[model samples]
Target: MTPMQLDLNLLAALDALLEEGSVAGAADRLHVTAPAMSRSLGRIRRSTGDQILVRTGRTMTPTPYAIAVRAQVHALLQQVQGVLAPSHELDLTTLERTFTLRWHDSLVALGGAALLAAVREQAPGVRLRFIAESSTDSPGLRRGEVDLEANANPPAAADVRAEKVAETAQVVVVRPGHRLAGEPAQPMTAEQYAAADHVAVSRRGNLSGTIDDALARLGLARRVVATAPSEATALEFVRDSDLVVTAPQATTRRASADLGLVVLPLPLDLPPASVYLSWHQRYDTDRAHAWLRELARTALDAPNRRA
Candidate 1:
């Protein structure tokens, strides 16, 4: 058959037949009758001059030619579907969607309210779901389970796209009456900072982090008395006790102020924590997804702008 006479339906049937490895199975998958699928297979064999699936004893096995072209056929089908899909202009007033965001808890505390308010004002039908980050790596983004992610760590996946939206300097947080809080005008030395007990914020429950590494380089170390699962929880530990926690300045500013804690400059040298917005490449051209990403970027940058 010439290229002009090629049938797209036959390509889909061939893909299913190769994947399922049985005529009956392929018919069931495509919601067609057995004889109808068999007739399509016969036409495919004549068109390609190859018996795509040959009967072996009781089961049907793919021929070498079928195995080689299986992936190509599936990919072509997807491309055709994408090409034929209708494009609809985004109508925020009547559009309804729920976007799932898996962000660091501190980020949620920093910008969740603003993002929600903006989305509600612009698109009353849109909803936001703020999920807590998992202690271990998850495939939620790759599998399309999570719509977006906001955190300091950028994903390493090749297909995932990450954009750095903001960065915040690290600062030390202490209770109002703590020794470090008393000397607001004085620049606390590394030795003085190391002398205080510390609380670490680690989702994985580890006591040591970048701060520990920086301290080690300076031949000093701080004692970590406890570990909190989130920065917000760590700030609570600092609010009522002498334990100090080093956190991103912008993200924790509001929480520290509400808790009546004092913020001090970190004595050790460390890079600022970078906040990245990550998503799968599949949503690159989705209009609604693009709208939400812009709002998210603005919300994340708001704290830094205020500072």
Candidate 2:
């Protein structure tokens, strides 16, 4: 048999009655007459198939069923309100909100400086909350804890909005005055490339990725001498040793003068690594949210990109 649905009005009336424990008080709270409140409670009892209330000497008492449904009832009401409430447009100049962003540290080292500068110029009152996790995507965006995910290379996901924020080529970085300084990077031979011990970058202690796979296909591979989580450590290692490292071109260029590293184009058919802007569809049209995304795009500043 199909169940007949009761009006939500009765549920609201029952909630007030349960809260006050007095018929007159519940009526006053709901701005209804005592008789009207009583009628709503009667309807609630029929719909629930329970004797939800019993009269005490001066007040009403809830039955076990009423107590069981109270929390669920309130939760539903809150959801209804959240759905109907309007999302106010943010005023950038005076708006103060914390936006959480997740990304791999490689991006932070490469693009964070420029990204922050752009945000500061546009929204001075905004604060950044960042998480540096290599696998920070999908679940992070859906959970609302992460507003953006910046990745070294775009990961595979369906319906995820992403675009190239920046284009970076894999460059062999070496310290100045090193044994291989000023050597022609272009037209590099696979044998010359694999000749040096490489410092690999990763969040995990393990050090291997697409670059290694490509090298293997060509019957050549570089020796990974060490692994680090961030570019800072990589630069530190390069500063004191002859170890050659491959990193995104932007990061290598930015730290070249300071860390004394120089860029060399990879000889084999290495694909261009691109940094992507990834976000969920939930905030697809949100104006304030889009503004932040634009700032990130601008900061990345791809050769043919707009934020």
Candidate 3:
């Protein structure tokens, strides 16, 4: 058959076959007979000039070509469904959907409760899964594994949309009686701030960051006694010892307060940390997703407003 005569049903059948790796399993998924599914798979093989799935002993395995086109085929089917699906008014009261969010621990601590409360009140049937950030980069948004992300880092992918929802200034955190935390009227100088022992917050356990670079500009460098994998852990070190930690003001406010740590203005001039809300372009027009984004924007902005 020519390309013009290609059936959309064949695409569906191909997707199912590639995913299930067996005609019988594909038939069960598409609610068709195994014989019918085999026929459709034959047609797919002829159209693509490929034996998409080959029998490997008793089990079927996807060919290299089939594996290569699997994600593209699935994405195309989803796009077609979105385009052909009728636009209906969203009914949140009875909506049953779960959105997965991968966010920084700090952002979750700051805005998660508020976002959850808003979601529960607005759409009681909707659920949320707040996941931790990964150590390495991932295509979770593009793969639809993650529905939303809130963090300081912006996505670099062209298909991922990122919006800056909030910005928070950096502040130095130390124990209440620490020397740098001395006078309320007197501000700490760059030299004074850099003279103290410090604990860096680095996911990769690096001893330095932008703060170190800024200090080097002034020919000053603070000795980092330790590096913690997270801001929470770094703050714990600050609470117990003289190790100072520079952290974002808004997100760390509650935690610092709880730890009884003193927050001092950063002596060095630096741009505020930006909190970005990111999602895949495929969700741009999804009404439910759009609603969740708005709520998230509000929730993330709350801390900055209070700051």
Candidate 4:
């Protein structure tokens, strides 16, 4: 018979007939009606071009061919069942994998050390690589080039899946002896903040951002003297000079403390930055991928000095 004409169900019926040696007995074994089993047997006969079973007096007996192939058919069915079964639980200790994460430089500074420590404790064989966030839609995650992307603002692609790992507020930071640092009150006013020269952090090197938009609405604007490519760069400029730098609390706490910079609440009402861990939907069911995703969520959720 041609491959197109061959039927899997007919093969199953053939196996049952060879084992049971009677149409009624095979029907009972397959949990099918006698008529349905007979039809299946007829199809199997036509496909195989064999009598398959013959009746002698009142009992049926399999042909030489059916007896020879019965064991092979049973083994084939068993192999198919094994192929369709679910995967077993993953063992992290023995699973060796490498994960690539893209993010802003500040996150690598603030939480990168802690995140690496946490992951290494359980997944010793796993390695992590961090890259900077790209400007345009690179589709790295979709192409399986990047395993994860963590940032305050993730890409807007609908195909990308994201989970909020932490929430951070923007705070104003400056050198120890900056004019704003000597303010009597803890939180300076918007005018007091606007009066100082600012250093803005923009990967694209743009001198303006949400801070500018917010300041304009208040009928006041800060003088942005310089634009740095990353948060770390902006913080460095803030440390040596009098430029006021605004940064996310979660990722800048360590840097600010190390630089001996003064961190203050933002004078204007700005929305808190929502930090997210994102991945392509392709890795949703991957056990190793799921383990890493959970590891990231746990690390970000756990209380830190800033929180």
Write model 4 residue lDDT over 165-185, tens digit each, in one string.
888789999999888877556
Compute the lDDT for candidate 2.
0.73
What overall lDDT goes with each candidate model? 0.90, 0.73, 0.91, 0.81
Clashes of each: 0, 0, 0, 0
- Which candidate number would show the highest lDDT if scored against the true structure? 3
Question: Residue 260 error for model 4, in Å?
Answer: 1.1
Stretches of candidate 2 off by over 4 Å are 1-90, 134-138, 155-159, 182-188, 302-307
- Residue 143, candidate 2: how far off, in angstroms? 1.2
Candidate that would win on TM-score: 3
Give candidate 1's total backbone clashes. 0
lDDT of 3 by residue, 18-57 (tens): 7788999899978999999989998998888999999989
Sliding window of 10 residues with minimal summed lDDT for model 2? 298-307
lDDT of 2 by residue, 218-300 (tens): 88878898998777788888888888778777766767667656766776677777788888666676777898998888766
* Per-model TM-score on C-alpha atoms: 0.75, 0.67, 0.84, 0.69
The lDDT of model 3 is: 0.91
